[model samples]
Target: MSDLSPTEVVEIEICRRPIFVVGSQRSGTTILASSLRHHGALWYSTEGYILNEIFGPERLDETYAVARLNLNRWLAREGVTREEFLERMGLGFNVLLSSRSGGKRWIEKTPENSLMIEVLGTMFPGACFIHILRDGRGAVNSMVNKRTAPGWVTDITWACRAWRRYVDAALEYAASHPDRCLTVRYEELVADPEEGFEAIYQFIGVPYDRAPMDFFRTHRTSSSFRRRIRSRSSHEALADLWDVWPLQFKRIFLEDAGVAMLRYGMVSEEEMQQMVEDARDPSDESPSWTEELEGYRSRRDLAAVVERGVPRDAVMLVVSKGDERLLELGDREAWHFPRDEDGGHPGYHPADSEEAIARLEWLRARGAEYLVFPEGSLWWLEHYTGFRDHLAARYPRVVDELDKCMIYGLQSVRQVPTA
Candidate 1:
């Protein structure tokens, strides 16, 4: 038995209104939401993927069904009845206050949640929405400047289209439900955090504390891509990373020229024409994980393991006791040494002068690509070369013959224990 202490786990919740934070990508959403996590009574995750699993890509027609499913799933997982789930969601205040400890609020933030605000409102009538908006020009500029998909790199035109679409959806949702929505522009947050947080504080009905705002300065990394990125200051700084033409185009066609911008009264008229021109030429490429290893083969192997009883792929070869447990776990074969009755070659002894050479030859003959002779075993085998160098010499042969095999290396600690 392990020596470490074991304790029972207790799950508790104290908040009722599930706070939903939504915003555009690279729009300071993570920093803002993660900062709010330090708030007492708040339990949240940055961009929970559960919504995508439940909702299936944010289409409007199926939104109601998806919301119901999400609610039901949450209820079942939390071991709460439907009535309790409904009450908790409606109160929006109970979950935070019900905790045994000081913590109280429960919230989740995801950029895609921006598209599902209406569905969310229907699901949790007591819910509050924090919509984080970045400057459209800066948003476009930021997308182009940072490590982005090939589509973003292909041209400023495509980037601008995406920006407008995201911002338009966000604004439309905000306008539709002004009472429930709280808009925090990224630029405002950076320039005057007190003002921005005051707006957030007022919307959520929580007293604003300046201390949590500093949490934004804490390092932020994109959970989706798993990359570290520097936080931007003002929206204008985002354009610093892009070329002049892209910045101009974002300012004109996408941010300044469009009716959406005019409605928001955000961008200037002078910027619109260049944005239109940029939109005329589109970049066709899109981002994908090209460097990731081909996963289909691994997936197929996993499926085989689950469905079939056969022992296949990366079996652990263990030295067995008389009980034969290892054989039960993995396919077994006799390992004869020194030319046994089966006419197999002799196993090399640790004491032999040419033991290392013999062991290598033995492995080659037995069709064993990798002979994992642990550290001390080599000294007995009369081997002098370092383990790494010895492996390097035979690596090519191993690849040619047994690349599919994985050999487990171990030190011979003790004789196999018999039960």
Candidate 2:
């Protein structure tokens, strides 16, 4: 700090390729960036705006002229050409990042970075960009629901256009620099994270490690926001919302995002036409079902049920459907039902009641003291009748409320005949 000028400090050669994770807001960019932050070789920051601030298109011609004149004067006084100034700025960014990166490569994430891909590519020629794309409907729905900031887009048309704009910008950049950029779909990544993250690591020229995949287990994003709007399964929730949106909203979304959706294979022409027709004559316009869906999504009462009913220090197996919210509700230890060998969520329900019973016995044998079925997963009781009967005939019900959850005390196993 005492020995060198800012210019002198920024002269260090940049040796590593920085990773830029760019995507539309609410397109899983935060989750992706948070996961990558767990990688030992990468240092991730919330958002980097310097590049965009310096290179973004000016909104007003007068402001642009004044800014350019002042910038040129400063550059002339500093005795550096514009290109040299840019090079040093890039190096300076790297130096600052490297300081906190602990000698590892650095990663930056910002939804707005989707629009600054060309500038980023020019500044860091060796940079790797991961463009995460989500289904436009889901992205727009989330954007409209979670209008967290004052200037955030809330209208259907504006949200749809914004999502398409970011997606098109990133995809356009990826098309030209295929070697340096990779586009990852949010749905595919959620479905099979191992394959997705493996490809990501390979593209970024880093050794693949399984630790980063555990980020979902360790990280919780906006629990309050999630409790308000998110469902146990985002894919299913989005599908339900799409089915219920009015005809006008659907047309607006399609007009702004239809082509991009087709490009991603999210919807075909036949399906798009079918969706439009279906929206025109929705079978159920009653608000009751929508309210029920929202109630199911919220899980507000379920949290209270878990916190109040589940005993402290009990090892519980929860039929969570990959939602991690319940995992944080109590002091007890919780594991997803039908969990993998590593205790991670299996991401799907058992194929049959027999399999469900087998998984239950497996977890019980491994010291699972209680079994929980949250409100969202109560369908398992009806769907897996044999498993439900076995539990009812054997383990005593510790907590059962129609609107909340069902908990079975698994202190002792009894040989009960299945129906």
Candidate 3:
């Protein structure tokens, strides 16, 4: 302010800045990153995992540099050169930002970015951070409910330890980089996103426009950007809707992550463990009563999704009868098809043929040893009538390329079925 030049001011106005969002898995980092990405020039990904995969699982002095180098090479492979790459890298990031049209800033996001904030700071001194905080109890509950990595919720104690490690590591980095960090609570963001986004937009020097809200009105496809927006809004709303979760949900959540909950101001520890103990062993005469009830319900109500009929030693295809492989290997000894109606032929529709070819292509891509083809009357009639000729032409060489295996069916067939 004392003697700032006009040129410097102008440069600052147009310059791009790096933004990093950090948090444990399932802690609303994606929503924050995406919300910002919706209207900003930044880019980010869910969790790049590149740093962990390439430079080694633990952080090291050379890890950050190696990550940056790999990213640059990846970009170059995608047709960006050194100078252009640097400019774009500074401008924006996303899980994959190559498709972002008309954005000036580079943005990329990975939760592990927090672990390397110091290294990132050294490389790009202007990097700013958005650290998301979810209530530890809620976070733990969410993690437990999720299909997680093995042993994630075997006990509350281990969950607490894992949750604390990530949160504490993030906090330590943010503490050192006060000027470059913004701590955003998930509850606050969901409750008043405009208020939250305002803070974020100001921090990142982006123009805040509600125009992107209209983007939400369009029907979102399964994997499109709009899908990401809709999913976030739905998740946030559900979090608010679960205000009346059972006492068990709360106790399990708290017991699992109560320490981190206290550190983040979500709870106070003086809250006795007696409450949890009482819940777990509700003095209901028999200790195994609850287990018995669960077992009974599972046996009586739940569909037998896990088919026990398939012998442990026999190879189970669990396929549809109309599946070409089903007919082709009608009498094959090695293959076993599902007995259920739905698991059999889904019919000879155009989509079915296309789906079959796609499945074959996928199998080929994954290095399949055998190709299965059904030989039902419907399949033969369709094949003879060129029902799937277009697909055959498209993937002409797929069937011929199996050097190691043969086209076989679940059961051996005497002859191709004719309509």
Instruction: Give all TM-scores, in the order shown.
Output: 0.47, 0.57, 0.44
Residue 333 lDDT, candidate 2, scale 0-100: 89
lDDT against the true structure, each candidate: 0.51, 0.76, 0.48
Candidate 1 segments whose C-alpha is farther than 4 A from its true place:
1-14, 57-103, 148-158, 218-243, 246-257, 270-419
Compared with the true structure, model 3 gives a TM-score of 0.44
TM-score, ranked from best to worst:
2, 1, 3
Off by over 4 Å in 3: 1-16, 44-46, 56-58, 62-103, 147-158, 211-256, 268-419
Cα misplacement distance, residue 39 of candidate 3 (Å)? 0.6
Q: How does candidate 2 fare on TM-score?
A: 0.57
Error of 1 at 153 (Å): 7.5
lDDT of 2 by residue, 1-419 (tens): 48756674334545469899999988888888888988888888677776666656332233334545774666445665544545555676777787777778888888887886776675676788999998888788778777474455778888898898899899988988899899998878876788999999999998987878788445635422244235546566565677767777776775677656755678765766566556443654542323432443346567678778877878988888877766655467888887888889888889999999999988888999988888778899999999989898889998989777899999986777668
RMSD of each: 22.7, 20.6, 21.6
The residue-level lDDT of candidate 2 at 138 comes to 79
Residues 1-419 of candidate 1 have per-residue lDDT tens digits of: 88666886757554445577887666777788888877664666546655545543434334333555674665445665444444444343344334432455667677776766665675467678888886665565556666655654445666666666666677778887898887887767877766777778778888767666777655443422112223444434433432345434633443332555544655444543334444443452221211111122232232333224322342222112221221232232323222233534334333443454565455445543223221212232235454334444444321111222223222122243468
Best by TM-score: 2
Candidate 2, residue 208: the lDDT equals 81
- lDDT tens per residue, model 3, 299-363: 22211211222222333332334433332222222222222234343444334555555554444
